[model samples]
Target: MASSSAPSSAASTAETFPAGTPAAAQIFTTVLSQGPLTRLELARRAGLSAAAVTKAVRPLIEAGYLVEDADTEARPALGRPANLVRVDGGRALFLGLKLTGDQVFGVLTDLRCRTLLARHAPLSDRVPKAVLASTAEMVRELLTEADGYGVRVVGLGIAVSGDVDRAEGVVRYSPFLEWREVPLAELATAVTGLPATVDNDVRALTVAEQWFGAGVGLSDFAVVTVGAGVGCGLVVHGEVVAGAHGVAGEIGHVTVDPNGPPCHCGNRGCVEAIAADPAILARIREAGGAEADSIDEAVALARAGDAHAREAYSRAGEAIGRGIATVANLLGPERVVISGEGLAAYDLFADQIRSAFAAAAFGSAARCELETRPLPFEEWARGAAATAIQSFITEPNRP
Candidate 1:
C-alpha cells in the first residue's frame, strides 16, 4: 500500500497520466471497476486485443498502480496460468465533497472509491466567500488525516447542484446555494493547492453509479433523485449527457400539470413543485391534517396513518412517476434508478409512482425498469470523488 504521507510532489506525479492511448485508459478503467480479470477478459471488456491488454497493464503494474493475482484454479497441474489484473486501491487517495445549501460534506476515498473517513460542517452563509472558506477548512482537516495514511492525496472533487459546467468548473446557477457564475474549480484549486473538478451533484452521482453501482454495464439508464428537489441524470450511448448548455436532465422542471402549483423556476405544475421535500411539506400544511413545517413532520404524520398526509405523498409520487415517464419516453433508457433523500417516504407513494409511470408510459416504454436505491449523503461525496478521478484521467484532451 502506498503511504498517504507521501510527499506532495509524489501526489502531483500521479496526476501525470499517460495520454493518446485510449485503449490503455479503457483497460485500466475496466479493471478498476470490474477487475480480477484475466488478460483475455480485459481485452474482451475493453474491446482490445490480448497484445493491447498486455501493453496497457505493463505500465500500470510497473507503477505499482495495478497488481496481478494468481488464481490457483486457473493454474494447470504443472504449466503456468494467466494472472488476474486489478487496480491497487491503496496506491492513491482522493478527496470528495458534496456542497449543499447549508452544509459541506467531505470524504477521503481510495482508488476503489471506498470511503476511509468522512467529515461534515454546517454552512452559516451561502455566499461564495463563506462557502470557499468552509471548504478550505474541510479540505485541510482531511489532508491532515491523509498524512497519517502515508499516501498522497492526488485530486479533489466538488459536487454542487444546479447548472454546473464541469468542463470549465463554473457553477452557472444554483438555486439552492443561491450562487451564480462561481468559478468554483479555480477558487478551490487556489485554496487547497490541489487540482479540482466541479460538477453537478446529480451527474457526479450518476458517474459513480455507472462505474460501481446499479447502472454498471448499462449503456442507457436514468437516475431520478427525489428530495429537497427533483433531479435526474441521464446516460445515453454509454456517456453521461450534459447537453449543449451544460443542463440536460432537469426532470424536476418537467411539466406534469399545466395548472398545478407554481415552482421556484416560475413555472406551474413542475414535478418538483409537487414532489420535492418542500412541496410535500407545503401540501401537508394546506391539507390541515398535521401542523407540519417540514418533510420529517409530514412523514411522521403519514406513518401515523394520517389520511391527508398520505394523500399528499400519493400526489407527489404521481408527479414523480410522470416526470420519470417523460425521461423514458424521450431516451428509452433500459432502466431508471430512483434515489434521493425523499425515498425516506417511498412506502408512502411507491404504488402511485409505479401506477402513474405505467399509465403515462407510451407503448413499450413502460418496459423500462424502475428500481429504487437509497443513496446517503456520503455517496454523493463519493460521486464528487469520481468526477475528480475522471478529470485526473481525461483533463489533458477534454474539449
Candidate 2:
C-alpha cells in the first residue's frame, strides 16, 4: 500500500488543497523553509526566475498559503519597499502521530508544523486493530481542538518504526509492533476520516529536522536516533533517500561487531543489538542482575557508579559511535543530528561515543559535525505533522 487508497463511505468530507502550478509548490516550500524573503531572494534560493516566483506566489497568496509583507528595511535603499513572501502558518492545521511500543504520541500542528497541542496515551497492545482504535480517538480529539482555530485539518501523518513503504502506505514489517504487510495509511484514513500518510518514524522526524530544525539550509545531513531502537534517516542532494526499496540509512543494522550480540532483526553484532534500550538492559542483567525495571532506574544505577550498569552503557555508546562513523564514512554528510530517548543517559557514555566515533571515522569524514539534540516524544509527533503538511502541499491528489 504505497499509494493513497480511496476513502470508504464512512470517511469524513475533507477539504482539498488549493490548485497551483508545480512551481507554486516549490516556491511555497522555499518560503516555508527559508521564508519572509524578497522575491529576488526567493528566486535565488528556489532556483527559479523572479517572474516565476511572482507567478507562483500569487496563487498561494490568494489561497492563504503565502502572505507578503512590506520590507521596512528595504524602503531606504529603494523608493518603494520590497515585499517579503512567507508561509501563512495559520492557514491550515494537520494531525501527526508517533506510534511507539508502549505509547501513542499525538500532536496538532499548523502549516509551519508548530505543535498547537499534544496528547499521549498508553498502549496496552500493539496489534493493528488496537493501534487504529487509539489513533481514531486521538484524531477526534484533535479535530475538536482544530475547531477553535477555524482552519481545516488538511491531512494526517502516522510514523512507525521498521520497514515502511511510504509510497504505498504499507508497513512491510515493523518488528516493534510485530506488524506485517499492514495497509496502515488506508486503515488510518478510514478510522480518522482524512487522508493519511504512513512513514518510517525516523524519516518522518528527518522531515521535520530538514525543514524546521538543525537540518535547515543543509543539502546533505543525517539524523541518528537512539532509544528503544537505533534508527537513522538521511538526506542526500536535498532529498530524503528512501532507497529504491524504501529502506535506506539503516545504520542501526550496521555491523559494528561481528561477535557482538543478537539483534531483533536476527543479525549478530548489529549496532542496535548492543545499543538499544532492551540490549542495554540485557547486558546489564547479564553482569549483575541489577533488576532495573526502566531506563530511568538503569540510568540511576550507572550514575551511582555501579560498574555493571556503567559498562552496559559504555558498550552501548561504543556501538552507537561506530554506527555514526559508518554513516559518516559512507555519505560524508555535513552534519549528524543525534537525538531520541536514549540521550537521557548521555552523560553516562558521551565520551565513549565521541571517542569510538573519532577512532572509527575515515579521514576527513571525521570532520562531519556530530551534535546531540535532546528531543521529547512530542517533537516526533510534530515530525509526523511535517510529513502531513508535505503531503497536503505536494500530493494533494494522492488518492
Candidate 3:
C-alpha cells in the first residue's frame, strides 16, 4: 500500500474522505487511476465484490470526490446503460514542493494530481530555517494563484532527496541540503499553514509515475533516476516498498566498483559515486585535467567529442547499468524506467548503459524492459502533490 499520513489540521474544515476503511481507499484509487469504469468493471479490477464496490463508492460520490455520468461513449447493449465513474479532479486542491540544494520547485494540483500551476525560487542557503522560509514564500505564491480556482489547498507535500519518513513527516537526512533529522513536515505546516507530507524525491516521483505515468498498470517495476543522485523507487506487488527503515531503494549507495571513488556516504564505488552528476564532473576533471564547472559543460565537452568527457559518461553508464542489474537480479521487476535530469546526457552513454545491463543481468532478469523518460523538475513537484492526494484519501480519520 502507498505510504501516507493522517490528514493535516488544515483539512479539518474541508470535506474529509467519508469512507475510512482500506476497502474504500482501494476502490476510490481504482477509479482515480483507471476510471470512467462501470461498477462491474471497477469490482473486477479492484478484486472486490459488486456489493463491496457499491458500498465503498457511495460515501465518496456523496462527498463529491467521485462522480457518475452516463456512459455515452460505450452504452450497454442490454437493458439499462451503466454509468461511468471517475474522480472529480476539481473537488479539492493540493500543493507540492521539490527541494534541491540550490532551488525550490513547487506546483499546485487538484484532487486528480494535475499540475495547474508551477513556480520556483532559488535557494541561497541550505540551512533548515532558510529553506522553511523559502518554502513558505513559495507556498504563498502558489496559494495566491490557487485563489483564482476558488478552492482550498488542503495539504502540502515536500519531496527531498534523501532518507525521508513519510508517515512521521520528517526528513531523516537529505544529503543535498546537508540536513539531518529535520522535522520538515511539521515545520512546513507551521510556516505555510497547511498540512504537510515529506518523502524522498525519487520515491515521490515514482508515485506520480505509478499512478499517472510510465509505471501505471505494471504490478512490479522500478524507477531509477539519474542526476545529482542515482535513486531508485521499487513497486513490488503493486505497492511502493518503503522498507522497514524507510530506506528501501537507496540504489545510489549500492556498491558497483569496490575500488572506485569515495562517496559522501563514506563508501567506495557506490553507484552514485560514479553515475551521479557531481561524480561525472569529477571524473571529467580528473581524467582531462580540465575544470568542467557544471554538468552542462561536461555534456558539451562530450558532445564535442572530447575523449575524457565521453569516457567519464561511459563509466557512469556502466556503473548505473551494473546497479540496475543488481535490482533486476534481486527483484526481477517487470520493467525498469530510467529517468531524471541526467537523461539530458543519455545520448552520450546510452549504448554503454544497455550493453552493461545486458552483460550483468542474469537470465530472466535481462527480460525486464528498460525505457528512458525525461521528467522535468515541475513534474517532480507535481509528484509531491500526488502524495498529498494519497494522504487525503487513504488516511483513516483521527480520533
Candidate 4:
C-alpha cells in the first residue's frame, strides 16, 4: 500500500494521500469533510470494521496528516473511549488562480483551504499569449512566497469563466477571455513546472464548498454565482456534476423571456441577457437614471435609492430567481447558495429574488433554501486550489 506520508520534494509537498486504496481515501475524505470523528463513528460512517479504520488511520497518523485528540470525558463505561481524528491543515500547500477577462487573481492555501496569501494583476491583453504570461508571473510570485514555508507547492489550479473540460485540462471556450480550445494545463505546466488542473470558476468554487464551506456534508446542492457572467455549479450524489460534454448547471443561459434582450450567445432573453453585469449596466443606461460607466456606478446609484437603478436590479433579481427556480425544480437540490460580485447589490434584489422564486417554484421545491454567501476573489482561487488538491489525491499519475 502507498504510504500516507507526503513527498519531501519542494515542488510536491502534499501528503502522499494513500488514495490508491478506496477505503483509505474514503476515510480521509470523510474526516476532511466531517472530521473529529471517533474511531467507532468513522468505522460506522465509512462502512468499515474497527480494525480497518485503525489500519487505515495508522499511516495517516504517522505522516502527520491526521492528528488524534484524546477525549477523556467520553470514556465508555465498559471500555476505553475512542479518540477523534482530524486533518492537519499545515502539512501541505496548494496554489489556485481565477482568470478573468482583465485580471488574474491568485492565492496560496494550506490543505484546509485557508488562504495564506493573495495577489492580483491586470491583463493588459486578453489573448492566450498575454494571459499565459500574466498567469506565469503571478504563479512565480506566489511560488516565491511559498519558499518561506519550507513546503513544496503540490499543484496549481486555474479557474476560468467558461466551458472547461477538467478531465482533459482544456478550456473548451471562455467568452470573457475570448479563448477557445486552449490547452491550459499543458501550457501552465510548461511555464510553472507544477502539475496543473483547469476548471470552471463556479465549479471550482463548488469543490471548495463541498470540502470546506456551506455545502459540506450535503449530497446535493447548487452554487449560483452572479457577476461578470452568471454561473452555476451543481453537486449531485455527493459529486460535482460535469455533464458528458463538460457543461452542466448553466443557469446563466436559461431563457427567461423570448422577447427580453439579445444575449452574446445569440439567444433572446437569457437570464444572463437581463441579469449579468453588462446587462444591468445597459439597462441602467437606457433608464437614464445615472451616467453610469460600469456596474459599479449602477450599484452606487441603486444604493443611493435611484428608482430606475433599483428597478433594473429588481428585474435582474426576478430573472435570476426564475433561473434558480428552474434549477431547484429540475434537481431538487437541498440548498442553493448565491454568491459572487453581484451580491454587492443583493439588498436591492433580495426581495425580488425571494418573491419570484416563491411564485415560480412548485410545491416543496420552494422549500429549497436560498442562501447568500459573500466571498472575495481569493475564494475562487482557493476553489482552484481545491481542484488541484483533488487531482493530486485522485489522479497522481495524470499528465
The runs of at least 3 residues in candidate 2 whose Cα sits more than 4 Å from the true structure, single-residue gaps closed, are 1-14
Which window of ten consecutive residues has the lowest lDDT sum in model 3?
1-10
What lDDT does each candidate get?
A: 0.88, 0.88, 0.88, 0.88
Clashing pairs in 1: 3-150, 3-151, 4-149, 4-150, 4-151, 5-150, 5-151
Q: Evaluate residue 238 in candidate 1 and report its C-alpha lDDT on the 0 to 100 scale.
A: 78
Per-residue lDDT for 1-399 in model 3, tens only? Answer: 011222233243344677668999999888888887999999999999999999999989988889999887786677777799999999889999999999999999988898889999999799998888788778877777787887778878889999999988888888889999999888877677677888999899999888988988888999999999999999999999999999998889999899999999999999999999999999988886456899999999899888899899999999999999999999999999999999999999999999999999999999999999999999999889988888877874621
TM-score of each: 0.94, 0.95, 0.95, 0.94
Which parts of model 4 have CA positions greater than 4 angstroms off? 1-9, 13-16
The per-residue C-alpha lDDT of model 2 at residue 205 equals: 96
- Provide backbone clash counts, one per model: 7, 7, 0, 0
List of clashing residue pairs for candidate 4: none
Location of the lowest summed lDDT over 10 successive residues in candidate 1? 1-10
Pick out the ten consecutive residues of candidate 2 with the lowest summed lDDT: 1-10
**What's the C-alpha lDDT at position 340 in model 3?**
96
Whole-model alpha-carbon lDDT for candidate 2: 0.88
| C-alpha-based local distance difference test score of model 1 | 0.88
Off by over 4 Å in 1: 1-14, 76-78, 396-399
